[model samples]
Target: MAKVNGKYETIFIVNPNLGEEAIAAIVEKFKTLIEKNGTVESVDDWGKRRMAYEINDLREGYYTLIQFESAPTFPAELDRIYKITDGVMRSIIISRD
Candidate 1:
């Protein structure tokens, strides 16, 4: 677990069409990236869900959360990848205490 000080909480939506293997691959990819010099405190599969809005015409998505300790710049890199990933419908990251 990360310390009681501030960290990051991120929720990235995966394309619902992606199966377990693909999803695992994607998760591993991000896990490696985010925790390169730090540690992942928690990960949660929020499961498949319906998006409140449309994204690439995808209405339903697989939601997951990753809490980690890292530099502030890390979230920017995460956002960049999320923007271009074909398997991600949407993503959001926030600071957590």
Candidate 2:
């Protein structure tokens, strides 16, 4: 099937142990990754917060939300990158349109 552009939001949690510079680099990396294939509408940095439960032995995480518009095919690549990146603890991408 042919792909169509759509609105999507991605929320990712990064390991809180990373330093400030490392955290910023991760955010910037994903921002540019999306901007390369889509138009980014907004980026909301939730900063570090206590998680309801521990993940990988960590009780806190840095949360970030990105809302963007991209082709249907693009999120798969985004997900792939997220998985391979070392400090990302979890992530989810949802279609908003």
Candidate 3:
């Protein structure tokens, strides 16, 4: 039988250069998006931190982690949004189930 839902954990790095308000907006955007599509288990904002390697000349980024349970197909749509969003430096979504 097909799984109706799956637990997922996603971590995304936002470009810190956008400043606090922009950063918060980005975080809120994703939080709402997730909440609309799933049951959010937790949202962890790790705040600004230096990266291990430079990405597009950036050395630091604001990080956020989200844990949720949703239909198995939702992560793909979430990932696509992350890739297209301007301030998102990087993102990864993993199935916890």
Candidate 4:
């Protein structure tokens, strides 16, 4: 039988150069988006941290991690949004189930 829902964890790096307000807005945007489509288990804000390597010539990024349970199709849609959103330097979503 097919699974109706699955557990997922996603982490994304935001460009810290955007400043505090913009960064907060971006984080809030994704939280609301996930809540609309799924049940959020937890959210962890790692704050600004140095990356293992430079990206776009920047060395630090704001890190956020979210764990949730949602329909199997939701992660792909979420990934699409991340790819298009500004200030999202990197992102990855993994199935936990």
Instruction: Return the top candidate by lDDT.
Output: 4
Q: Could you give me the TM-score of model 4 versus the true structure?
A: 0.96
Models 1 onward score TM values of 0.83, 0.95, 0.96, 0.96
- All candidates' lDDT scores? 0.83, 0.96, 0.96, 0.97
* C-alpha root-mean-square deviation, candidate 1: 3.7
Q: Model 1: clashing residue pairs?
A: none
Prediction RMSDs, each to the true structure: 3.7, 1.5, 1.3, 1.4
Question: What C-alpha lDDT, on a 0 to 100 scale, does residue 87 get in candidate 2?
Answer: 99
Q: After superposition, how far is residue 56 of candidate 4 from its true place, in Å?
A: 0.2
Clashes per prediction? Answer: 0, 0, 0, 0
**Residues 4-25, candidate 4, lDDT per residue (tens digit)?**
8899999999999999999999
Runs off by more than 4 Å, candidate 1: 1-6
